[model samples]
Target: MQDYAKLRKAVEMQSNEMKRIHDVHIDYWKECSMFFSPVRGRFLLSDKNKDFKKFHNIINNTGLRALRTLVSGLMTGVTNPARPWFRLSTPDPSLRESYNVKIYLEEVERRMRYVFQKSNLYNVLPQCYKELGLFGTANLNIDEDFEKVIHCTNFTCGSYYIAQNDKLEVDTTIRRLNKTPRQLVREFGLDKVSAPVKSLYEKHNTEGDVSITVAIMPNEDRDFGRAMDKENMPYIQVVYEDDAPKDKVLAVSGYHEFPQATPRWEAVGEDVYSISPCMEALGDNKQLQHEEKSKAKSLDKMNNPPLVAPASMKNTPVSALPSGITFEDSQSEGKGLRSLYEVRTPIGELTNDIQEVQRRISSALYEDLFLMLANDRRSGITAREVEERHEEKLLMLGNVLQQLNNELLDPIIDRTFAIMARNNLLPTPPEELQGVTLKIEYISVLHQAQNAVALRAIERSYAFVSGLVGLYPEARHKFDSFQAIDEYGEYAGVPSKIIKTNDAASQAQKAEQQQQAQAQAMEMMQQGAQTAKDASQIDTEKLQELTGA
Candidate 1:
């Protein structure tokens, strides 16, 4: 029973402004869905199960298929749930070698992997990827679950409205949830719910779910320097009945961090919402749909055309089947039943045109960029050619990868870590490193793909330097072979245990040098003793006599 009037007003006014821009996004997203994700979002609760029949106008299905490929590429390349994709490290490189620091990080990584696997993060990530590529933005909610350690939910695009701070980070989210009265009573408890909803729950009403709007935003008025409470936490979540009286709130809660992660593919100038890859080919998709429809109609007309019949045969039946019999006037010789006119569909050119459009649409979505490596079946495709194509893709995906890191992957890790730490689920860290800021290093397949390019460069340089050694042996000394080995191992995502630290390597080299020095000294001593023995055997006296001394 907290008075959240002030906070509620802020959400309402901001939501109105958000709605205007959100509507603009809806217009574009709806068009994109016609060919890409036809039934993805509820979209104002317009209808269900009808999208495939109504707006799914693609005859080639190339757009829909390309969307799937993009999702798979992102999942495997960015954050493959099946494999360990990210590592934890301190900002200070020197601390990374500390046994305590290294051990703590390893334990943390292990726990994180376990939690993500135990949760449904991987199950819902594909839909999040699809929404990002199709709508230019997507939302993911991460919360703590006592049973699962962590929980994740992916919200359909356009179903929620979002606002950002000056830094363009999403700090506030308003979502319209459809929940049954029984669900609401079970979730927030009957005492905290609205009377109408409570009555339904008590009466066992079988009516449909109620639409409730919940807003999570920054609690700016609280003193962040002090310990956080539900009222004084960093972010507040308010749930109010939709279309009910003002201040008809169901529940008010808070969180230590913003739980929603809104990852955008690419944002336009000063716009909160993003413009997706789907928009690039929207024109082509619409035209392709039109062309295919026209082709179908033309073929139908060519096969089943309107008939021309004389009045004498107006009452007669005409069978249009393969070989049908029709009784016509016995004396009618001029005409019986004939086609109204000829239909030259020109289906050949039309088909080719449709294919060209299909190719264009696929290219717009960057389908060829990903499929080239896996789908190419041509002979004589060299490894160098594949590497060059991979490099090209890396260069093109540079901005996209960076954005995903900044907006998606980074936030998810930070939020998950925060939740785990609060529940005391992580391992203890070194006393000195408690206040140290940790950084995330992405080793996902996508990131390694980028690193793979650098690996090639390093190897090529090493080979070139080695080739020069025979001509100018000093060239070998100029190359930092030790540093090169370390760099190569890192880029390959080789575990630290497999690669020795610099200190260990330097010590090994020094020990080897000392052993060589000892061996050389021992050899010199042995040779000196042998010479003395020869002298003792009177070789010197024999030499002097031969010299007539």
Candidate 2:
């Protein structure tokens, strides 16, 4: 038996530490809050009421729009609009008949798609984008029903720890669950159990709500006891008990492993949460935009300066001035007169400054690339040149793409596979593949582009080496044509079904050679028979000549 109380306490302590770490990056969270909710943004809230009202009246909200576009573009790239985000592979090269594995994986993918669709993952993804943009991290929880698996994001989900050995893998996770006592009883299947369980459920029903913290972690012992059954082959344990009912454990269940991992689209240094530094730039841009509007308003006022008159003439009707026939009183003939003069608002420099600030904000968000493409299109630039430029810009996101592959796409795929396996929704693996583990290969456009750089380098190397080998034959040995082709196929996202296995290719070559040898032997036999026939005929001719003489 495990010490449930002690373990729970330790997990709680760790969760508190993680929360403290999260609090340090609260400024990033504030930025996200401002992006989504301008009225409630901390910046706006901190200003005086009158000043905030002015900001509200003139706020452009271009920053929010830019952030939205950036998030959408990133989501589209990573999710792979053309096809699935990932494919399955195996580490074992010795395994032949990968076509069967492919079929199995395809079925699994189809099932996963069904579950995701049912769970409205399309809706959940936007929440992920919001979390990633603001906090630089997103969490997904997989919950199962009888018919389908549900996937959800827990942006506010708290208290998770990752193993020190692997930064990418999460070791343990805890989530707060709110439920009524009766609901808990039903969930744990305690309604039909002991009288004490029933009484406890009734007592909780009288209360308003109950909160339970469920913790999932790896099992410490490797013993194959009753608790370590085949159903829980991966040997992860789950423990849950009501905070109110501390003495009595609610339930203890099993899982393949902890079903949560922190997926970050980007990171800075070693921090768990690192938002885009561009957010600060966006805030500055907003402020500048407000100031520019204020200056423009002042300039307009200066261009049509307000009328000023002497105290005696102040009582004169303004309608008389608008009629262009102002009549001064006889007593104040020349003393009271209105003068018209320009205030001279220097707006040329201010306009230039505003444009520069806008440019900086756009560059920070990568909107400048889009603007460049748009301008290039108008200029009738060739498609090839535009593509080259776009690719060059994409290089800046190479690290982000890699992080998505490892932290987000790969884990989602693995967890989806695990869910399908647990539900028996996938086809049974062949006997030979019983112990084989599947690996994920991302083939999205973004992923392919990330590999394109290395592929280009390999191509260049091969070209140079082949040229050298033309002059120096020994140089040919330095290149491995087969390995090059294999790598090219992988980087190019070539389908495995189209490529022949080494063993299969060798077998085909051997068969062709045997057919050629058999043909040669048959030809030799026919030629020998013809020669024999000719010799017999010559012998016959000689014998006939002899008999006639």
Candidate 3:
């Protein structure tokens, strides 16, 4: 009979504890929903550039520290003698340990310092907690008074486990198999914990069947363990259908809730889910959730109505909801607003990467076309041959680009080149000209060097479509087929100019030599005439002198 009475008391105590815990958990979820929903909604379409830095900074600066603080607080609330809340109670003669708080706070501060050192936020946010070391050491003595049996090894730097052993030395097998809150509290100290608070940890259980057990503790004060006044507690209430599949519970688990122009709760009395309350409590803040809500609301009201179905189709179902209406239907009809939104193509894994390479190659091909055609007026190569050469060069260029794209430079090259092209820095093909056979060849020196030393090979070849376009401007209208080529061969401009200058110089030299030859021929003819006259006079005198002798 005595045994039965004790059993009954234990059951009653367990029941009350469960009820309180259930209420606390439900409230926590409500706050979490309120905090995350608005942030998510606004962040989806927010200015990613402006807000991304701040968001990243917060996580970098405070992530580990905040995690540690909440974990430690939960441990303390369980071990505190005034209100032992976890499944187990503190050991006998357990006293509220002041040093423990200081210790946990110090650990938190230490983590914050480490986080500051490791993250970019270290430069942005001023050092508000500089003496974290001293503060953490000072608090180390706070939990010494508690009757705690700690199972730990100092050799393994951060592997200690603490638990309230009032009932018995904590079941060693249970502690080894699964860590309990009491065990973690002992090891990490009540000052700084590295685990999630009990309530958040329990919710995590519903999402993933992880073996991690939560460490529960009572709130230190009625104001839910926060430093602020009860009235100032920021809480957003939200309601949303939990459409999560039983198999995929974590799909939306870590969502934040925050208040904005569009309140986290869709309607106050409509039982909508909200993230605002949780954001207020946890300080997960955003600037643009507020801006977008205001913008969306104003844009909806001031915009003219969209187009409707023709009056001839009055009886059609399409008339009830305009065919073009996407966001709204009834009020948007007959306004003739252009549809600015369109469904985007789902990103296929292959196309996203390969397509970027193709685009770069395509741009280079056009540049090659202009470069080759604009400057190739003197090559003995025929217009048709030039066209063939362009085709060959383009093919070669495509191959090189494919190689570059495949070289595993996807992460850096794809995004970087995309930015360059979008900003119009990439060269484009010039308009095709008539009667010009444009040969465009794109070659990579690096790749070609491995095969053979192809010196002065046109890297990017651009040419006018037809040779006749330059000789006869009338053929310009017939010109077409301009393209961009890859960068593989040497530029053709300087070489072509050198050839033209050389030809002109050779012609000038030939003309000067002809004039000098003509002048020498005339002088020789005049001298020959004078010599003939002298010779005739001498022959006649010799004949007379010979006869007289």
Candidate 4:
């Protein structure tokens, strides 16, 4: 019923566009591939004559090491130890008083974490790092099944591309999969086919073939239902070609978004490829060092030369001569005798150059920061200084982290929450909070660290104002004490449960004021009663004096 030919043509067009970008970046990809697997590099594979093998013996993998280090650092910051990866909050600050909503959100977060843990998201996350490291982009697909409410799968680079869209969200994505006919039939519920077709599918079940799966949100105005009705095919399965509902498939992309001007989607992210020149130099330096060492060994072997003699004395060997043996020549007084040629190859400069290149490579990958932390204790560096240095490195990743939050973490959480909501795994919100939408707050160490910069600035400003207030008491009124406390608590990553809401704080203040007023009234009444008793005593003394007269 659906126009299969038209869809295939659109797919082919998208593929061709993506291929063009891939071709332009093939060299960079080859370098990254070689960094991980040297033999995969075009330069290594093109050695049909086996010439490079003889000279370039050492294939340094520092490039791969740097890539892994960067990836690990990113993961560590993203999943910080001090806080959860994400939490739910209300967009309206005043809603903090709604404890029921707060509790419901907390439950949502707990369930989300449980789902992720059950689905093995921790393992899936590393694949994303690999993709990001190699291709500067990562794709994560979220789906649901009977066994797992929310399941996640990672797609490697070059296997998927985004379609044209006016908004930032990915509405359509085309992915290539290699599956057997049997798998396709089983997955898509194609068992309703005729007997002969079933037999044919079973025959080729073992032989897998590549298939393209396109996910798109169809236009509402399109007559897809009419087309299916005309074909008399199954409504959902025939249209989607999958057993699962179309809306359940969520595709999320991480890192740089594709440029609008380009015909195809291309990720322009920062990665090891950004420092390709340094990585290339490191590899070359390593090969050169190996070559120099080989040369040095060859020179050492040629330190002593064997004497050459006429045909009559050809049988004489160099080992037969003694250490101090004198060479005697029957003709020309040994003038034509062979002489030792001293060969000297200085490797000190080569070693220094290699070391310098290694340093440059390390600098390019921010490895120097790690080294600083390693030596900080021994060097007696203060903790504050170490933290400041750490922040400097984290600042470099601010943009990438923001993208990951938007394109990776947020989508994953939203999809998981939606699945849970559909399954009724979340707590019921109170009537007041029924219409309120939950927002995500990232409290991971990296996010907190990002906030720390602004927090530090606030602290400095407060300290400076306090110093002025100390000099002039009247300056205290200029400071907003409560606002400062609240802002500090928020930026300091303090848990919401631990901090009192504004309404509660105001109630406590009013109660304290009432108690103070009652105490003051009781004191006034007690003083009045004492004054009346003193006056009564004075009148009694005066009457006693008059009776005595």
Candidate 5:
């Protein structure tokens, strides 16, 4: 006996609470998106085409180009589609290096990449990243697809509502989506949907899309000791027609993990929503547009200034068109459509100001920082040198990148791994690695810059030790060579197969030492036997001399 009313009430309460805080951000987000991104805002029915048709406000396209570059830069720096930018490892470094675990994790990484490539992840990811830049908060749903192995759906900021737990982690996701009647029935089936939805479906009333709410929240009854199934799992999903009776749920299901990843760039204290660089630079964006608009008007006046005519020629029509003769009075010869106030607009200075504002907007969005690698014109510069050149930028983004790893990439990979494991698409883990938890290590370009600090430390330490080795060769004993090798391998992105596990390396060392010990003992025994033979010959000669033979 599922309490449909209770479930609906809980979902509505959570959603209402989320929307209460979320509405404040929506007001500004509407303005922000209008200027930079060309995408239409689909938050409300009234706001549908209102924001959609307002792209004319963007008199300058600098913001648009900067945002596009921001998206591409993020893709290259964080999760490059062309490379395996992340890896799976256990918390125990030694465990990660074990041959079996290493092979299994590699297989897992390979499979996950395949799934990502097959799915719409790479395509929709830019949308998510774009929303993140524009709104500071972005939601992406990672779900299972039988054919694709994994499926990704990105929700623009205002279209969704989310609640955070006590730890400020988003565990509740409520999406207000518009689905056609046919879509509802196809998804939940005829018998599962509400009466209103079914009526429209059966009558072929597909005239317009109807709004529905889907809620993903904690299953409150899981603690009541009910048998665990899809419906009774830890987190539950409830989808229902918004206009249907409040007591009926369209569909009910559950997930072992939170399938939605909601990432916020700069979350203020205790707020569910976040503020982004778009919001920060929105003032400059508007100023830039205004400046550009003013410049256009100035140019317009210069090209076609307003005209004034004398009373004598008031009856005659003025021909402003090109190659048209106006019967302007021979009396109005000096006043025949001449320049108005000499049209003095400083075109060069206005352009300089507009460019300055555009540069400010780009800086707010970290455009220069993100595209530092792409913008570099240096020849023969290694990746490390480029990273070193922009190390400060990476440090600036350190906090955001950490949050991105936790809020976005972590859950995405975790959900995909779960789907693959559920479908038996992965190899079984070794018994030794049975209980060890898998962790994701981002080795992307941005993360490499973060690790470069530690790598530099290692390099400096080795250089110091090399200098001291001639004077104090035993100073090498202070640092553990094996641990240094392990860390270097990890930070250097060395393949796991290239490095042996700590246990394996230790065992090999012990075997070599045992062989050396055994050979030394055998040599000592042979030397003693040779000396004994020499003593025996001396004894024989002495005895012969004493007997006078």
Candidate 6:
């Protein structure tokens, strides 16, 4: 029911573009093209350029050209306009990292050709005489419906697409069967099957009109022998043919198709034919599904917010403290305690708000940086360029954040500590202090944490920006929300508490002990209001008379 053709084309287009890059990457591996090596330097293939070139030329000259000619001639049983047949293999993830495109291609073709022939056998044989079916196995005298009989082939890769008529679906060269060779030999007997049985029980046979073969022609240098085996492993081949005969036929020699006794043998060629018109139509339908899925995925990410702090905290206000001394500390006994109260309520709100702003900005930056790194993986952007841009942006952001820290947070932090020190709330100084302390250690910790938040934000911003550019390098200007933090802007004033003096030790002790007193006071106020409400429930005149109003 699926339009496999369109899907195939979409996959083809996308894959081709990706494959071009992959092919370039292949060349890159041989030439040591990439700057950053994820696997360090050991396994990279820089020294094998000359060997790879020679290897490719050998296949193009011999095996592939012959295979193409053979495929064209064998299609409709006559040699004419030959349709070009490309190589295919099992979809092996492990093999991709160490892909031997040339050798793997040959092995796949060979196995596929073998599987295709066997698959055709079921269709040509009479239904009653078909030896491969479930019904024929149980009863040798049953009538078989060749018309109703739909032959199926279980390929080495377990892909059913080969059974279809429209497309050539090939998988990577990774074996999907779980059974071990010994287990297979004990169960299925390797002697009964073909010679190049890498593992036992791996049934490499053809069920339908599809051509399946174990394409194996390893080159000396590129073969990599045991190493390549560990990487791609080998896969079984399967093929099917819908137009083959439906009635049983007499037994024939498997090797009779290829008359040559030598390894360099030729296959019978058939007439070339264009793909069926019906199959072309199927390709269109599959393309639509791929587009819809891609669009939906894009929308989902757009709708989601950055995974971080609450929305309310995204924006924060700058500080604006009045230049009044109404609450100025005068009492030496209350110096340290004065700092807490000396900072006006509005100023406190402003400072908290500003801190939130800094936090958000920094977070955004860090996220941007991470996104950039991600983009580089897909966008062909070099890591060095991304890093360079990241450094520039980070320096700019750090400067702004540093300036803001100095102008806004620093002063408030200084004032707060001064108040704490005066009230004896801070730890006793190693030495008696008279003038402005070099640094307020308490605020310094908080400041350092804030700085970290800011620095990380810059990192994130770089990541996000890099990703945006990678995804849409040509149109990245549209995402202006990722504005640089270094743009010149007026800074908000620092918030500060009134400078007051107090009995440092006594006030510090009282603040600790009187925390319970504050709670008690609040409770008393609640009780008083409750009592007043109860008294007010009585008539107003009676309440007024009782209180001698």
Top candidate on TM-score is 1
For candidate 1, lDDT tens digit of each residue in 504-545? 788999999999999999999999999989878887778899
> What is residue 145's positional error in candidate 4, in angstroms?
3.4
**Lowest summed lDDT window (length 10), candidate 1:** 46-55
TM-score of each: 0.91, 0.70, 0.18, 0.71, 0.88, 0.15
lDDT of 6 by residue, 1-549 (tens): 213233233333443343333343233232211111111111222221223333332211222222222222222111111221222222432222222432433443344334324333223222111111111010111111243221232221011111111221112111112223444344445453333332323454322112221211112122324443321223212211112132211111111011110100111122111121112222222233333344444444444312332334334332224663333234333332111222123434444554443333323223344345446546886534544556654443344334323322233233333333334444433222223124321122112323344455566776787787877796556543312322100010011111111233347768988998999999999999999999878898887999999
Candidate 4 lDDT (Cα, 0 to 1)? 0.57
- The most accurate candidate by lDDT is 5
lDDT of 2 by residue, 203-277 (tens): 664334555566666665445665556234453544454454433456556667556656675666565654553
Candidate 3 lDDT by residue in tens digits, 1-549: 013233233323443553443333344443332322211111111112233333332312222233233223222211222221111111211111223322332343333233223333222111101111101100010001112211111101011122222432111100002334454344444333333433334444322221221111111222445453422223211111122121211111110111101111111232222222123333322222333344445455445334444444454333224465333345446543333443232335333443443333323223334345334535565444444556555444344333222321121122222333344433442232223222222122212222222222322221443555568778766532121111121221111212222234557879999999999999999999999988877776778899996
Ranking by lDDT: 5, 1, 2, 4, 6, 3
Candidate lDDT scores, in order, read: 0.82, 0.61, 0.29, 0.57, 0.84, 0.29
**TM value for model 5:** 0.88
Q: What lDDT would candidate 3 get against the real structure? A: 0.29
Model 2 regions lying over 4 Å from their true place: 1-15, 36-58, 94-119, 154-254, 265-270, 277-283, 303-307, 313-343, 369-387, 390-392, 461-482, 506-549
The local distance difference test score of model 5 is: 0.84
Residue pairs in collision within model 1: none
Worst 10 residues of 4 by lDDT: 255-264
- Superposition TM-score, candidate 1 onto the true structure: 0.91
Which model is ahead, 1 or 4, in terms of lDDT? Answer: 1
User: Clashes in candidate 5: how many?
Assistant: 0
Show model 6 residue runs off by greater than 4 Å.
21-26, 33-549
Candidate 3 weakest lDDT stretch, 10 residues? 134-143
Ordered by TM-score, highest first, the candidates read 1, 5, 4, 2, 3, 6
Model 5 regions more than 4 Å off = 46-53, 317-336, 502-549
